[model samples]
Target: MIRFDQVSVCYDGTDRPVLRDVDLTVEEGELCLVVGRTGAGKSTLLGTINGLVPHFTGGTLAGRVTVDGRDTALHPPRELADVVGVVGQDPLAGFVTDTVEEELAYAMEQLAIPPDVMRKRVEETLDLLGLADLRHRALSELSGGQQQRVAIGSVLTAHPRVLVLDEPTSALDPTAAEEVLAAVTRLVHDLGVTVVLAEHRLERVVQYADRVVHLTGDGTVTDALPADAFRTASVAPPVVDLGRLAGWDPLPLSVRDARRAAVPLRKRLEGRPAPPARAGGAAAGPLLSARGVVVRYGDVVAVREVSLDLRAGEVTALMGRNGSGKSSLLWALHGAGPRQAGTVRFTDDGAAPGAAPAERAPAPLRGRPGRLLRGHRAEADVGRRRIGLVPQTPTDLLYLETVGAELAQARRESDGRPGLDPRGLLDRFAPGIPDGVHPRDLSEGQKLSLVLAIQLTSAPSVVLLDEPTRGLDYQAKQQLIRIIDDLAAEGRSVVISTHDVEFVAAGADRVVVMAEGDVVADGPTAGVIVASPSFAPQTAKILAPLPYLTVAQVADALAAAGSAR
Candidate 1:
């Protein structure tokens, strides 16, 4: 459907080409997933397909890009719109209309389709995307997931043969992300629409991808068959990780396939009893406490009577289905949202002369008493630099020229004392990216790591990360888990809001499950994961219930069992 020949794209502002010597092709009805560490030119490659790179962004193009035989340079975005539909990472930013129905119809109208045809297409799109109930709703009234669906529906309504979605589900929660991805998969599998997407959540979508396109920091592209691509690429899915361990030649993409591959190992186990819980150690006092918090947006109650305590030196997993109030709770605690009635206290259990709680005084005071121990807690005032946040949409934080400069800004502005080496810390945490390039140019995984480098630069005691591993491949996920583990070992309190149950089970010390603006379950990680009626434990854990939530944990358990036997 699209081909790039010796393509080198250099934007007007910068001297270096964002994508250099990139030669690639996408056949009709092919589903290709483009992945790289952040700033690695994945987005640029996609932009080139629809004439957004050199054309709309005012860049110099040295090579030819052909979409359905039409040269991208000769055809602008409008001209390509009939053949291609592009949905970017931020759905709200792309919205040009107020209502969902209007948004879906706007593209058709632009194409000059007749009124009857436009109406039929809009109706079909609404039904296909499950937007019938939301047809009359304003764009602003929709949640991030709904808005993303609308963005997709608007594009799909154009009935373009090729669909190029850039991080389509990055803003959505887990269930919503699955819905959007499933919809996309159907479009390719059933409808024969060529699909090319850049995403961070590899595990969820890798199963559906027919091919994987790997890009490096240097803007090099390589085509790999699904299995080969995942194995050699920067990251792969959890099933791939499991396949590697089990010595499967072609990695299984789905849990069902993984289970079949594991049958031999299961038979070898001969029904060994599952392992016991690891919550025997007494948990410490509250590192950060919240009591009777109530936060509402207009007439909608986001969080009601929610209370919890995060202990020192432990990682807490905040989990829920999409729009289940996980983000709202974090915002309320961070003071980003209004709290009708609540108090958050942060203090060291061993600290000397701890002061009484400052009632409704200021956010800084609440974080001050604990500042001496842990640099930041969510309750801290914005200016105090006590809490470091990695927002759901990481792009919101990226406006710097280089990754190094971005980290430097965080180090300079953070509450940490003088003499902190931002570069050294970034190297330690994010290590691989080139030093001089802009952060916006990196891949999804690299961008995530770069932001983490910035968020953790201050060495804050409490770090709040929303979906840190959502888009990462298996390798990147492992790397991020190790980083989080090290942070937890440093006595820093980390709260990760995510939908990856495996992440929560494997990495977190405790798990907090929220639904409908209330915490439904909270306890030791293993306990909460197993207890949740909505959460189905990973197959490895179900077959061999380990205290840990990762594949490494399962490996350890098996090794220990072999030793014991």
Candidate 2:
């Protein structure tokens, strides 16, 4: 259904081709998954399918690309709208209407479909994506997961033969991601729709893909079955790593298969205790405290009476389903959003000895805080800023055109600090970003790194990151784990609001689960994540009594056991 014959793409002002000699084919009714590191041309490859690469993105295409035997060069995106439907990374960028029903129907209207058929298709698409209940809700009011489903429904309504999705489940919670992936699977199996999807979170979608398209970082592609492809692929899920560590004959792509093959490995780890929590030691004092915090939007309350403490030296993970008030609480603590009713206080440990307490003073029941929370200078005197926040949208903090300009600005804002160069920090967190590339041109992971480097220039005592691992590959995620660990080591508090369960297991010391605008469960990572099946990692699910959270931990335990014997 889709074919790329000697395809190569190169954007203006760049010498190297983003994609080079990529000859590939996708059979009818097949689901192909594209995996690669950040800025590895996965997006470029997906765009070529629907003719958005050279047409919309202003790139040069070397070879012919066709969908359903229709050459993309001859037909622009609008002309091929009937044959190809593309959904981008950010659904809000593509949304034109306000409400869910209108957004879904707008595509059909553009396609000029018959009114009767468009209406029937809209109903079926809503039912298929389980968005019927939210049909009347405004698109802006929906949760991230709901917005994702609506975006997919909008494209599905057009009844395109080929569906191209870029990071479809990156913003969704686990349950919602499963629902969306299941809908995509149904489209491939039940309706014979060809799907080409690119996602950084391989664990969530690898099981659903019929074939894997591995995009090596150096401008090449390898196509193979899921098991065969993962053997040498630079990026892979935890289950794949577990299978490799155990020396299984064929690497397991899904958790179920890995669990079945893990019988012997589980026996070896039978009596071993899980690795110690990264932040097992006790912290000195509360760096920041929130008392009876409440946040509301119009008539709806997002965060309700939530009281929590961030310790001086610990990594805390804020986890819950979609729309569980994680984002609201983060913003309130940072003093960027409406607090409604709350007292956010910074302790002396986080402040200077003579410095007055930085407080988010409560106003009326519907009023916001008097002043925004800035990092305590005392903390800055000790070689660290008081607080830094990276919002859910990283781009919101960026404005400069080139990466060099952004880094230079960050350095300048640091006021000629002794050892705070933005370029040096960028290398530590996310490397390989060119000086000339625009901030918007960087991949999601790369952009997060740039913003994180900018925020770290202040040397903040507390760091709050919302979904930092959204677009990071496994290697990039490992780098992030180290970065968070270093922050905790510096006696700084770190809090991350994310739905990536494996990331929580790997890095977080404490897990705080919120539901309905309240803190429901807060405890050590092992205790909290293992108790909930929905949030537990694959290793924890397979090795229940052993308390293991990752394959790396299991491998270490076995190696120690062998040496002792």
Candidate 3:
């Protein structure tokens, strides 16, 4: 249904083309998954589908892109709106109406569909995407996952032949992500609609793709089946790696297949003890404590009387379903969100040991509530800055024109602590980022690295991150894991609120599950993840009773067994 012939896209003042000599064809009803590293041409390639690349983005296109036999070169996005529906990484940006019902109907109104037809399609879309309960809810009140479903429904209501989604499940929990993907699968199988999806979390979507397109960072694309493509692809899901490690004849893409092939490997690890749990905050007293925390906005209570503790030199992961108050609790603990009936105490050595919670004054607000929630901050005393937070939206902390400018501004704002340099930190966190590149122009992973470097400039006692793995590729996520480990090694506390189960399995020292504004489960990572089927990682699910969270852990156990033998 979509074709790209000898396509090359070059932006203004850039020496290299983002996409070079690309030739691809996506057949009707087929789901094509595009995989690539950050800053690759995946987004650029998707934009070319509906003529948003050269037409709306002011880039130069050398070759032809056609959708449904209509040339994108001859048709702008508006002209092809009926044929292609594009949903970006951030659903909030694409929303045009305030309420879920209105947003879903906006596309039909644009297409001038008959009133009766529009009403019928809206109801069908609401039921299809499982958004019927949220139809009357305001768009702003919906959670990230709910907003994503609404965004997709808004386009599906127009009955487009092609759907292009970028990181559609990044913000969703495991269960919610499955629901959305299942809906898309039904459209492809039942309705014969075409889908082109790009996602960083391959473990969630790789098994469902009909074909995989691997985009090398050097402006080239290679299309192949899932197994062949992932064999040599730099980034792959955990199950693929496990298959490779076990020397399975054919690499398994899904958990069920992997488990079947793991019988022998499981026997090899039978008597070996599972990997030891990583030490957590209990070694030292709580560095930060939240007691009876309650956060409310108007009549809605995002967090209700939740008590938690963060110990020095520990990594804690806050996990739950969408709208479970994970983000609210993080913001409250950081002293940036409204705490209607709670006390947040920074128990560092600077505070009096015997001082009561009420005696300690709250930290002054550094920026506006919105800005602070996005990780932005004004200058403050280095010693007094006990907590640093990177919110769900990393861009809120970035406003400078270029990477160099943002780094220079951060250096200037620093308190001249010894061995603290933003430029050096950026190099360590995300290498190869050009100084002249615009902050907005950088990829999602790169933007996150920039903000993380900015937050680390303060060298606070505690670090809190919300959805840090939203758009990060496997390699980028590994680097982030190393950063988190290093922070704990240096006696700093770290807490991350995320729905990426694999990430939680790989890095988190402890897991805290929240639901309905209350802490439902809190314990070591292995116990917490293994108890719930929904939150368990692929490896744990595959080897149920084996207590292995990752392939690496299994490998370690095997190595220990070999050594003992």
Candidate 4:
């Protein structure tokens, strides 16, 4: 029910067009998925559906776009609001109401929906999105994933014909992502709602998509069915990659199909072991020790009496369901969040750049109950900046106008010391970012990379990244994996809080799972994730009893086995 004819979009201050000479059509009741690299024009294309591109985000639109028989060029976002509902990459930025329940009803109220209908829709949305428990929680107090659900619910309550979701499942855990996608699929199947979704985590959504829209970095778009699209897709999910690895005919599209084809491959790899692992933590002592830590928000005990230790040269993946206190524990260990009762002891030789060890006293956390990581870290003692954190919303840490300015500011904060060069680090993380472009204008993945550069600029002994893979595509995630490996090799401790199971599978040295403000599981990556059905990656599921977490690992095992089949 959406059509684009000779569409091309160019924004101000950018030389090349973001979308170039494109023609596409999304049929009624079809679940269309947009896939592309980090800087591709996926978001720009989605904005055009509701007339936000040139109409609100000033630039030029040299084509005709229509949704549900109405021309987008002739209408502004408000005029098309009834036909289209959008949830953007940053959910908190789009929130206008104070609480979850209120936000869900705001869109319907604007549409002049009857009070009775609005009330019913809001309740249905709460149950659909699992937000009933959080109905009264302040939007600001909710976790990043919670805010995303609220954003989607806010739009769903309006009953728009077309739903445009940008990275809808990025913040959610594996189970939560599945629930949301399942709900979206039900809408398309039962109510004939057309959905146009763009997501970075392909594994989470690819299985649900009926069609694929690949946004070539050069601006053109490729539309095809799921099988045709993935066959030639530049970045594909693990199941697709596994099908390709096996050279299976009519490449499998889902884990179920892949598992059926995996029988022969399993026999080929029966006796082969998983790839040799690295020296995790190198038997090092704790870099940071937190004991009896507790965090409280009003009457809510966000974190209970929990204790954990971070060893040098280790990459620990913090995982759990949404609001399971993963973020709270990270903050508590960093001494930034509240610690109702705890003793934090630290002994890092390289606490901070150019700071003497004697001056770097291990300062304790706050004694009062309450809570808060993920940004360039600066501590009171030593002025050494021993710890760095990159929080869920990486953009909140950025205030500068351009990417270059952010990099320059990071250097200034760290005194331009060696290994503290933000520019060099950013080049490694995300290359070719323009120096003059505003940081806010950068794509979601690019913004995450920029913040990563800023935080790593301090050369902290311990780096804490919460949901670092939110906006990153598979290629960018691979690059990040390399970075994580390098950080551990340098003897720096790393703790990452994320729900990207595939990411943890491929990169993490260890996995720590939290639930209900307590540590539920902690052990090696494969052992912890493979044992838990809720957290297993597609590869782990497809090749169950094999202990293979990634497709690449499986490929390596086959190659090493010298299997001719």
Candidate 5:
């Protein structure tokens, strides 16, 4: 259904081609998954399927791409729209209609399908993707997960021969991601629809993929079975990694397979205790505290009256379903988002000496206690800007044209302020980004890194990242883990609002699950996540009933046991 022949893509400004003479093919009704590091040409390759690379994106394309027997080079996106359906990372950015039903029918309308057929397909898609209840809902009112489904439905309504998705579930919560992937699998298995998906979170969608397309960071491509591909592939899901760590003959692609092979490993680890919690040092007073925090939008309350403490050396993960107030709570704590009623102040957590709570003073940046801002306005009389926030949309914090300009502005902003070097932080966060590249041009993961570097330049006492690992591959995520660890090591409080359970399992010191604007569960990482099937990571699920949260933990325990014996 889809084929690439000697395809190489190179943008005007960059030196090397994003894709280097790639040759690939996707059979009809096959679910082909594309995996690669950030900015390794995953998006560029996806674009070629529908003629977006050189045609619309203004890059140079050498060789040919054919979708459904039509040459993408000869046919532009609009011409090939009927044959190919594409959904991008940000669904809201692609919506052209106000309501879900209208969005679904919009594509069919453009293709000039009969009114009756469009109506029928819209209803079927609504039921298929489980968006019937949201049919009348406004596109802007939908949650991240809902928006993504609507976006997919909008394309699916057209009944294209091939569907191309770029990081479809990158921004969704775990359950929501499951829903989206389930819908995609239904399209593949039930309807025999061909799908080409590029995703960073391999754990979520790898199980559903019929084939894996790995873009080896050097611009080449490898096509093989999921098992064969991940056997030696640079990137593998937690289950596969666990299988590797346990020396299983064949790496397990899913938790069930891994669990079936983990009987012996489980027995070995049966009596071993999980690592101790890091809550002891966290008891030394909260570097930041919030009480009765409330955030409301019109009549909807995003964050309920929640009181929480953030310790200086703790990495806290705020997790819940989509729109469960994780982001709102993070913003409320950072003194940025709308707070209907609450008190967010920096306490004397030993960082500051003998200072009473300055309720009406300023933001915590200056070590001065300032209550959370009630509305949109930032705190007044702020000292050093102690709390830094990287919002869910990293682009919101970036307005500069070029990356160099953004880094330079961050440097100027923190010139006299005692903070980390912006340039240095950028390299550490995401290396090899050219100085001249436009911030808007960077991939989602790269943009996140730029914003992270910009935010950390303030050297805030507390750092909050909402969905930082959205588009980051395992390699980039590993770098983020190190970054978070380093931040906590420096006695900086870190709060990551994310739905990437594997990321939380590998990096977080504590897990705080929120639902319906309330803190449902809060405790140490393993204790909190291992108890809930919805939030548990793959390794935790594979080694069931046991509290092992990651492969590294299991490896450590086994190594310790071996040495002791």
Candidate 6:
């Protein structure tokens, strides 16, 4: 069992305690979920579990922390390493060795476990987590989810009694996140090890937790069962919401459980009123056009023969694997790179970067007299301001005091009307209650929302979002989709570059799949996703036995199938 008695941790020179009086306990074999909004001390709480909070972090610590009959206050992490295995939020931070096998065996080597035992454990862990095939693969070559699994596997190889994870799935897509979570569940259920995790993707993890440790932004920890914890919390998963509406006893945690609880709901569906038809928005002409665009970086063609038309009021999803040139394509579209070939034109429907009065280039033809060639134009300065680009990382755009301030700064830089309410955009997309807090302290999802809000502040006719849902959870992905839909409905064209195939199918009106710097497929969302040889996750779920993307479409398809039967 792991126990914390009145534990308080304070970073150096900071008057505020990151974690205060965090009294909690997790018995052997118990699966405890630690949940809160961003900067709510969730990471701090997990650090305390593995002795990183006060030990490695150089923090002022108070009170007692006991793990499996050992006092954590007196014992250093090295002394307790054999008993507690910790996987941090960024798995890369914990990686020590180069190869997957070496990484898995490093902890065992530290403990001086016999070579035979180490080898046996490594093989078992690799097979258990589906890393057997990837044993020889370099850490750098694996996807984000695969790397995280390797990190977890390395620690589990030590056979620690307690396992603690911090936002393990935050960096993964839906399918990857599901695989990691399922592996975690198997570890606890089959191996009888105590598991403690801090995660924002409550909709996915909450159903599996035996108990919940709810922490407020103020750094207070309270223990409650899953239902009670969610009841008093600000956020909840979709199943939790469904439970509240249907008044299910003991509230179903997983979708399977929810499905069982929904037997009565299935009956009610027979007479349920049809939803109103979704009226299509007005179609606008292409605002940005790329014709035969080609970009090469030192012999590697990042984009070749890529032609795309960005409509004024639509969201286009650009899908590709890692190193598949999605980012490169976005850069070319934003004029961040020099196109060796082709033409990118900005129409008069939006502010042409070259046409903007603020960006007028002083021009004189090289061969002509200065006075005679003064009216000549330069293409470089003209194209710069026409496109407003939002990069993948939120921190790249955020260096402000509060969420409001960040949006205000964006408005100031924009060509639109000054004094635009940042909160209005945030409320529409995020709708959370962290109104007065610093934008940097928000959750990964919230931070993305704020970044997009700042991007929208420009009121550009064309908005480019790169992996907006990259590090988000299921609910967070839904939020991003809603934001994309809203942006398109407002007649602002959006281009989303992402690996999340599900998001592509659900939110984008059109899908463009790229590989080897070339467009492999481009069509309407359903048409492209369904016909493609490469699998798309969200669409795969619907197409498991039905072909649909949105939940409403799923319902309609089911009804149609039922009537046919």
Give the TM-scores of the predictions, in the order they appear.
0.84, 0.93, 0.94, 0.94, 0.92, 0.70
Candidate 4 global TM-score: 0.94
Write candidate 2's Cα lDDT for 1-565 as tens digits: 9999999999888889999998999999999999988878898899888888898888799999989989999999988998999998878879999999999999999888999998899899888877888899888877666788899899999888999999998878888788889989998999899999999888889989889999998889999999999998888888888888889977888888888898898888887776663534566687878889999887778899999989977899999888788988987886656788977767745344433222322111111134221233333333234566787668877777899988886776566764346787787666777899898877667888888787777656778888888777887777778877777777778999998999999999899999889999999998899999889998887777677898788888888998989
lDDT of 1 at 337: 45
Off by over 4 Å in 5: 276-283, 349-384
Assess candidate 4 and give its lDDT. 0.83
Residue lDDT tens for model 1, 381-482: 332344456766676667668876777666655646642355665555456566786776665556677777766665665678887874465455656677
The best candidate in terms of lDDT: 4
Count of clashes in candidate 1: 17
Q: TM-score ranking from best to worst?
A: 3, 4, 2, 5, 1, 6
- Global CA lDDT computed for model 6: 0.69
Candidate 3 pairs with clashing backbones = none
Question: Candidate 4: deviation at residue 117, Å?
Answer: 1.1
Give lDDT per model, in order.
0.71, 0.82, 0.83, 0.83, 0.81, 0.69
Residue 236's lDDT in candidate 2: 89
What lDDT is reached at residue 433 by model 4?
82
Question: Compared with the true structure, what per-residue lDDT tens digits does model 4 show for residues 1-565?
Answer: 9999999999888898999989998999999999988888888999999998888888999989989889988989999999999999999889998999999999988989999998999899999999999999999888888889999999999988999999999999888999999999999999999999999899888888999999878888899998899888888999999998999888888888889989998887777778743334463777877778888888888888888888888899999998989898877666656667776666666544433222343221211122211131454323335677787878777777788888887776666565556777777666778899998888888898999888777667788899998878898888888878878887888999999999898888899999989998989888898889888889989987887889888877878777545
Q: Residues 150-176, candidate 3, lDDT per residue (tens digit)?
A: 998898888789999989999989998
Total residue pair clashes for candidate 5 = 3
Model 4 ranges off by over 4 Å? 277-283, 350-384, 563-565
C-alpha root-mean-square deviation, candidate 2:
3.9
Regions more than 4 Å wrong, model 3: 277-282, 352-379, 382-384, 418-421, 563-565
Shift of residue 98 alpha carbon in model 3, Å: 0.9
